[model samples]
Target chain A: MLEAFVFATILFGFFGIILKKNLMMKIIAMDVMSTGVIAYYVLVASRGGFFTPIFSGETVAYADPVPQAVILTAIVIGFSIQALMLVGVMKLSRDNPTLETSEIEKNNTP
Target chain B: MNQITIVWIALPLFLGFSGYLLPKLDRYFVLGMALLSIAYGLQRYVAADTLTLELIDSFGVTLVVDSLSSLFILANAIVTAAVVIYSWQTGKSAFFYTQAIILHGSVNAAFICADFMSLYVALEVIGIAAFLLIAYPRSDRSIWVGLRYLFVSNTAMLFYLIGAVLVYQANHSFAYAGLSQAPMDAIVLIFLGLLTKSGVFVSGMWLPLTHSEAETPVSALLSGVVVKASIFPLARLALMTDDLGLILAVFSIGSAFLGVSYAIFETDSKRMLALSTISQIGFVLAVPAASGFYALTHGLAKAALFLIAGNLPSRNLRELRQTPIALPLWILLVLASLSVAGFPLLAGFGAKTLTLAGMAPWQEAVMNVATVGTAIVFAKFIFLPFSAQPEAKEGKKYTVGFWIAVLILVGGLVAANGIYMDAYTVDSLLKALIKIGIGWLIYFLIVQRFILKLPRGMEQFDQLIGVMSLMLVLLFGMMLT
Candidate 1:
């Protein structure tokens, strides 16, 4: 049930991305969606009354270790892409001081 | 270490580092790495054996040098090499240079990986590479489009992860060999997320805008070369689930029709090429949906077509409206386009034949519709080079080596068909002509009527493509239920 919450928040934020005209809002929405997804993985990783993972020598009540591992890689890749997007945003700001999300080189805007 | 396993992952890492260190050396390093891998991959491809090696603990990923992976891996290697030749002087930053090599490597990695978890990681690598490169042009729209892809792909990746956890629960194993029949619901959910990544449909709305807004060569790589990487998982899912055959058959056919509708209306030759790509991908997916040979054959031809389109548009074709031979290169590209349209002897013919052969009688209609769809879209594409007159007075002579490479590829494909299939008599040629005739008739009736000359007209087409995709998504939702 809580998984639905995280997904809803993510989709709501994406609507901000699609609806809002601000670039920062879009980036924030992107971050929001990423966090929602990460949370979903963590939650899903923990199933049943006691989520136990079998490990060598010592067994621990670990959530699905697979989601954790996968989410870790997703986080790293996400950070790099976020960095790339920020670089692009910085370039756009430099080229055109006002960064409207939908602007595509319209001369009349300025 | 088996040569296939080691070479697939390590060579790119080695090439990437060297390419990163030396700006002048990156393209060649990437080109060399792809060529080397193709040579190594071909051996396993011919052996028809599943090759493997562990890079770590029992937890380590296995490289499955089977027919499926080898076909995609070798095709990518060929595409990347041709890109190096075509982009001989593209002095983009060292960042993109290294990224391109890693991208190709990541793609080859995904194709060869045997374990579900390894395939997932490799897919993540490819997805990140896609995100970075899509906006690497550093333009305003490129950034926006890249973000669109970022949001959609990451979210899809989450669904894929959840799907993975479920699969683990159901099957109790991750090896391709261990992929016993997963529950239909689990398989369907996993593919739902993955379809977005692969740009098939439902999740494929990002295809045209992102691929089109990026720089030409990168666009080519994204549409032509990069899309194949994601097919690995989708194909695996299809192999796992019983219902996936029908799912693949239906959705790919929808993608084929939808992709063409957009392409026929697009004005920018580059973006039109991009739309044509989605439809071409539909063909590739359809082949594998039915059988293996189609997947292998279509992957190779489409990769070549994408790479060729990436280079040909370095100059907007608007200048050659009248001079028929203004760009003689178009003649060969037309041949490439012909091959993509499933004209007989070209590579697509063999693949399409197998795809159609595998289908039951009922499914042939779907295949035919896709063919006419491909024809309708590419008609816009084939006529584009000739639409502009010979007004390009720059008189820049194309490099001798460039034409040599193109001619060699064209000749090699026809000859390789004979070698690969062992008998390419006049029968193939006649078949190809018939296919071309069907495509040509569709163009005359439907596509030619709505012609747009400048990029502005394409904006309307993009919007229309957007609307059409949304409608299909709604329809697909009902169907999937």
Candidate 2:
């Protein structure tokens, strides 16, 4: 059930990206999609138990922490990409004064 | 020797960062490091053994250097040096040098990294550097194009990350060597992402616009080496699985024909060259053999061509007639074009002959058709620059880089077709000559007499997204059946 929900969120992100004409909406969609991926990884990492992965005599059923660690790196990478994309959008808008898909497409043709 | 792994990655980054700190010495720093990187890469090539540098085993990030990786890094290092040399004459600011250096380091890192996480990080670094570099000139169109490239690239990376997760879920490991038991679905997912990055047809439709719109030096590197970095990993993955080769071969033929066909109708010089890159990369991706030779030769030729195109007054082919250029520059451009056209005795011919010897008859036929098409398109590019004007002086750096690339092409031709200096059989030479003749005839007869109009829909940004998604589905279906 949780997998289905995460998949749905990812799909929602894709739809938002593809369907929206606004550049800001597209960036938001990207963040949503990345978040969905992170959530899935976190869920996978916690499958064994809710306990932290740190070694301790008291906690025997610790979930896998590797996924959590990897996902953290992924999150940082995703955030930077998003930041760069936003900066690009800002610069693009400053030049054309409009963020409409049609305007951007028309401007793209050389 | 083991330290060579870290040095190849670190030296460039250090030099690039230091260049920022000392802006006056930026160009010299970048150029010196580029030469140093090449020398180190060559040293590794001479040794030619796999060196693994374990950074953090728990994180599964390690750098591995094999002969294949060594060759790739060497080629990348050489072309990057040329790019740095070319950039010197332009009087580009410190930021350009910094970005170019970062790009060089990341590309080298991508070639040598042994695990998925490091590979992922390398790709992202490349993405960031490439995006900023593409938008460096900051024209409205360049920025939009760069944004499109960034978005597509990010989406592709996400798909790749998800694939990595799937593999990890199944096998509990993230190392490339540990993917033997990985599910077919996982493999397919990974390849789908790679397809997007490889600049294949449908998936990588945004490639031409992005490549053509970037600054001249950046375009040269983009066309020459950056795209190949993505494909190197795909090639490595294909070695581990049988299904990827067959699938790759089919897509390769499609991209080859499609790219050349688009080049035929394209009016802009850089865009035409960009399209041809797609076509040639199709050949690179077609077979499972070490495509490093072809990639290296193509990088040299394409970089020189893009730089030549940069010198032209305008990008239109017709403009070449009015503009005056040096005789030696013209000669260099001609050799580069012939190399791209797969003319006999050139590096392109050597790679084509070797790759063709291994393919099935029908696939060979399709590739031949693509070659003829390549000849037709490049004939226009080469003949356009010919003028009777006196020699005009070009920058020393530009000329030097061009000659180096031309020499490398010749050297590679010798290396690729070793023994028997005239390696092309009389029959094969005759066949190649006939193909070029026929292509030229068709170009004048049909292309000029009755123009072939292809819709520019594929070049549009949204349409490319639609095609990429559709092609992913088609690829999945192909894998199933």
Candidate 3:
């Protein structure tokens, strides 16, 4: 049930990307989508248990370290891509101050 | 010696990043690295055994250098070298060389990496570098194109990541060998992501726009080699399942017809070339066994053509017809264009034969029809007149890079196909001639009567996402049955 909800979150973000006319909203939606993916990985990692990955000298189930490690790398990559997109948005705004998709499209058409 | 596999990816990356410090010498450094990569790739191609390098054993991160990847490595190296050479006279900024060289390394890594995690990382690096390259001009339009490319590609990759994670959850391994045990849904999602990246069907609609809008050499790289990044892994996955292979085959045929139909009516010369890329890439996807050879042939030929397009005075076909081209450049254009149209004795002919050898009769027939369409599209180039202008001396420096690219293309054809003896038989020659003749006749007799435009707004940003989601649902439906 929780996994289904996570998928909904992803779908909601994706719809935002598809439906939003504002470029900034689309970027935010992209972030929302990626965050949802990251959340899904987190949920998967904690499926075993929520205990620390390090040894605690007790008999306890620890969360999967692999997904966490992988998601860390993913987070960094996602951050970088978002930064690049933001930079592009700023640059694009120079020509079309509104930053609306329709306006940008009109400007782009030769 | 297997450890040397890392060098193939790392050298360019190291040089590219460090290039910021020595902006003046960066181009030369990248050029030398590209040449070294080609030489090393040749050495690996000649050797018989597959080499595997284990980078992180616990994570299953390994680089596999096999016959299949060696061909891609060679193609990537050659195209990089050609792009670097072609950009010489254009005087691109240091950042351009940096991104180009980085893209080269990441592409090589994507081809050789074995596990999903490493592959994802490599692909992300490739995407970053490609985005920067596309936006290199800093113009508003180029930035918009780059952003759209990034958005679409990133969304597709997120799907891929989810699929990768699902596979891991099922099999407890992220390696390609572990994919056989993955669930159907995971495989479908993965295939969808890869197909998008490879510029197949609806998801690939961004290709023509992105490829046509970038700088000339960048356009050559994107069309010629960058799109092949996902195809290597996609082919590997298809090899594991018959259902997936059949699905891919259907899409490949569809992409071929769609691309050529677009190319047949496109008036912009560069845009036509971009559409033809989508068509030729379909041939690569159709026959996974021969994909490497087909990609190499198409990559070299397409790169040469784009380099030639850079030298042309105008992007419009009508304008091109009015302006005469230098004799030497015109010859090069004809040779490269003919090779892409699958003329006898060229690299594309041999690649096409290999691709068709394993296809069903109906698929083969459809592919042949697409071949005629391809010939018709390129016939526009063949009909162009040679230089009648006395002032051709003004831009002679530009032809230097064109000569270098065309020479490498011809050299690649000879080296790879070795005269293509089997493809040169009378029956095949006659078939090729007939196709070319019919294509030209159609161009001269029928196609000149109309000016057709692709329905507007299909390739826009929002529509792209909508189409992608529709494709995901469609793929799910197809896979379920």
Candidate 4:
């Protein structure tokens, strides 16, 4: 059932990228797509059990910790990439004073 | 925990940051260190056995250097060495050197990684470093192109990450060793992601634009090896998915034709070379066994071409007669162009002959057209130095680096004679020579006459993105049903 949501979110993101003329929105769509994937990973890792992953003396079944840890690193990487994209968009907007990707090149002030 | 493995991965990155930190001493220090590192690396050849350096056991962040990767590592070393030497004069900024080093380390990491998580991280590293390098000049068009590359590639990488998730859900491991029974959707998604990075048709439309807009040496590296870093993984993926072979062959053939056709239409030298990269990559992907060898030879030759393009006084195809280049540079240009066209006695010819032995006749014919198209495009350069006006400034270091690259493209055949010699028979040599002859004839007769020309509409970003969406749907349908 959750997998369907992942698909829907990915579809939504693709629509934004394909339809949106503003570069910032396209970047947002990229972020949304990554968010969908990250959600799916966390959901899959927790399927076996719901207990805390931290180990204790008692034997309690626990969820897979790998995906959570992996997601953390992935999140950081994604954040940095987003930052870079935003920086690029900022520079682009400053140069053109417009948000439209197609118009930016054509209406260059310089 | 091989000590050499650590050195191979870490030294470039270490030097990269140090160069940034110590700008006054950066030039000589980094160059001397690079030379020293190359001297040390040449002493012993790394064998194929897997060596895993585990960073985190649970998430599978490990680095693996196997026989496959060792060869790529060797190629990367040679290319990086050449780039360092050539960029010394052209690359004015210390930050450029720093990015080059980090790019080297990131590419190495991507090549050597053992698990999906490490692969993802390494790929991101390569992406970020490449973005900086592409934007190094801070020119308006370059920044915009780099941004497009960033957005497109990052979005594509999500497909790969999602694929990894599905693979992990199916089997609780991310290692390549356990991918045999992975879900088909997961495989398709991963392949789609990689195809974007690998510069295959439809998906790789941004490559030519981005590569052509960068600084000349950066463009050389992009066309030469950065694209191949993504291909290394796809090569491994091919081994696991039997269904992918047919699809890959078809796409490779398509890309080969598209790339060469576009190259024929392109009048800008750098853009033409960029288009040819897609074509050459197509050739390598079509032949699996000799893909690595093909990539190495292509990298050497393509880098030499880009560097030569950098040194040219004028780059327009119409200005070929007026552009006065040195005799040695002219000779080097011909050698590089001929090598790319698969002329006999060159390394590309050796790779082509070996790979063609296993291809179907129709596929072989397709590759022949690709070769002809390459020859057609580069034939423009044959008359560049017709009336030498004055030699362009050529630095001694840059010239030496260019010659070394050409030497590798020629000498690599002798070095790997045992593996490739059986395929280099008299019949194969004659066939290669005949192909070149035909290519030249077609160029002089048909292309020069302007009897055939392809529209340049696909070169635009807006149109390419539309095609990319359509390709995704078509590829998904093909893979699933």
Q: Taking the tens digit of each residue's C-alpha lDDT, what string does model 4 give over B1-481?
A: 4786677677777888888788866666545554544443333234336677776546455676665665565556666667766765553688887877788778877777767777888888888889999988777777888887787788778878888887787777787654557776777777787888878977777788888878777888888888888888777666555667777888888888888888887778888899999888898788765677777778777887887887676677767656566676687788778778877666777878876876778888877778777777778776566445454355523456555654544454345444456766789888888877877788777776673456656655566556656777778888777
The TM-score values for the models, in the order shown, are 0.84, 0.93, 0.97, 0.91
- Candidate ranking under TM-score, highest first, comes to 3, 2, 4, 1
> How do the residues A20-110 of candidate 4 rate in per-residue lDDT, one tens digit apiece?
8888888888778788888887888788887889888887778888888888999999999999889888888777776888786454211
Model 1 bad stretches (over 4 Å)? A1-16, A48-64, A95-99, A104-110, B1-4, B53-61, B169-185, B289-319, B326-328, B379-392, B419-432, B449-481
RMSD of each: 4.5, 2.8, 1.7, 3.1
Location of the lowest summed lDDT over 10 successive residues in candidate 2 chain A: A94-103
lDDT ranking of the models: 3, 2, 4, 1
Query: Worst lDDT window (10 residues) for model 2 chain B?
Result: B412-421
Candidate 1 docking: what grade? acceptable
Summarize candidate 3's per-residue lDDT along B1-481 as a digit string, tens digits. 6656666678888899888989998889778887887887777777847888776545667788877787888888898888888778777888999999999989988888888998899888889999999999888889999998998889989888898888888876788877778887788778778888888976778898999888888998998899999988987667756667888888898889889999899999888998898888889999887888888888888988888887687889988888788787788788888888888768888888778877889889989999999999999999987774536546445647767876887678656776245777788778888998899999999777778877747787788888878888888888888
Per-model DockQ: 0.33, 0.68, 0.80, 0.55
**Total backbone collisions for each predicted model:** 9, 0, 0, 1
Q: What is the Å distance of residue B341 in model 4 from its true position?
A: 0.6
| Residue-level error in angstroms, candidate 4, position B122 | 1.3
Q: Give the candidate number with the greatest DockQ.
A: 3
lDDT of candidate 3 at residue B252, scale 0 to 100:
90
Q: Write the per-residue lDDT of candidate 2 for residues B116-216, one digit (tens) a residue.
A: 87888888888889998998888778778888888888877777887787778776778776565777666666777777877887787889888988988
* Residue A29 displacement in candidate 1 (angstroms): 2.5
Model 3 residue B146 CA deviation in Å? 0.7
Q: Which stretches of candidate 2 lie over 4 Å from their true place?
A: B54-56, B321-325, B390-423
- What would the per-residue lDDT of candidate 1 be over residues B410-463, giving only the tens digit for each residue? 664564454245324476556556766787897777656656643443232123
Clashing pairs in 4: B48-B67
Tell me how far the alpha carbon of residue B59 in candidate 3 is from the true structure, in angstroms, after superposition: 3.7
Query: Which pairs clash inside model 1?
Result: A45-A64, B320-B388, B320-B389, B321-B388, B321-B389, B322-B388, B322-B389, B323-B390, B344-B432
